[model samples]
Target: MKTLYDVQQLLKKFNIYVYVGKRIWDIEVMALELDHLHQAQLITQDEFIQAKLVLTQQHRIEEQKNNGRDL
Candidate 1:
C-alpha cells in the first residue's frame, strides 16, 4: 500500500467497495475493514501494516494541506 489507489485495489480484491465522497474517509473505512480482516485472519500482518502506513501518511499529508490553507 503506497497510495490511495493501492488501498482501493486492496479493497477491491476482497470485493469491499466504499465511497463516502471523501478520499480520506474512504481510506479510513478501508483501514477499519482491513482491521476486521486481520482480526478474522483473512489478511496477513504485513498487508495490514502496509495499508495502515499508507492511509496514515496520506491522511496526514491531506490534513497538513488543509491546515496550511488556514494560515
Candidate 2:
C-alpha cells in the first residue's frame, strides 16, 4: 500500500477493522494482517515488503514524536 489509508482499505476488504488508541499498535496490526495476506497468497512478497517498510517508517516517526514529548 502507498499509504496507511490504503492498508486500512485492504483490511476493510477482508472485513478486518481494529483500533486501540496507539498508532504503533495500529501499525503493528497492519503488519500482522499483511503477513497473513502474504502467506495466503493474496498479496505479493513485494507488496508485503513495501507495506512493512511504510509501516516501519511510520512507527519510527510516531516513536520519535512520543520521545520528543517525553523530553
Candidate 3:
C-alpha cells in the first residue's frame, strides 16, 4: 500500500486492529501482525512487502518526530 492507512485497512480485513496509544508502538505491532499473516500465507508476498515498506517508512518518520521532540 502507499500509506499507513492502506496498511491498516489491509490488516483490518483480517480483523486486526492495533492501538498502543503511541504511534510508533502501534506501527511496531502492526508490523508483527503483518509478519504473522504473511507466515500463514493469508496475504500475497507483494502485499506483505508493500505493507512492510509502508510500516517502515511510517516508523522512521515517527522516530524522527520523537527525536525532534526529545531534542
Highest-scoring model, TM-score? 3
- Please give the lDDT score at residue 34 for candidate 1: 83
**Top-scoring candidate (lDDT):** 3
Clashing pairs in 2: none
lDDT of 3 by residue, 3-53 (tens): 999999999999999999999999999999999999999999999999999
Model 1 bad stretches (over 4 Å): none
lDDT of 1 by residue, 1-71 (tens): 67878878887888999898876677688789988888998888998899889989988987888789899
Per-model TM against the reference: 0.86, 0.84, 0.98
lDDT scores of the candidates, listed in order: 0.84, 0.84, 0.97
Steric clash count of candidate 2: 0
Which segments of model 3 are wrong by more than 4 Å? none
TM match of model 3 to true structure: 0.98
Q: How accurate is candidate 2 locally (lDDT)?
A: 0.84
Give the worst 10-residue stretch by lDDT in candidate 1. 22-31
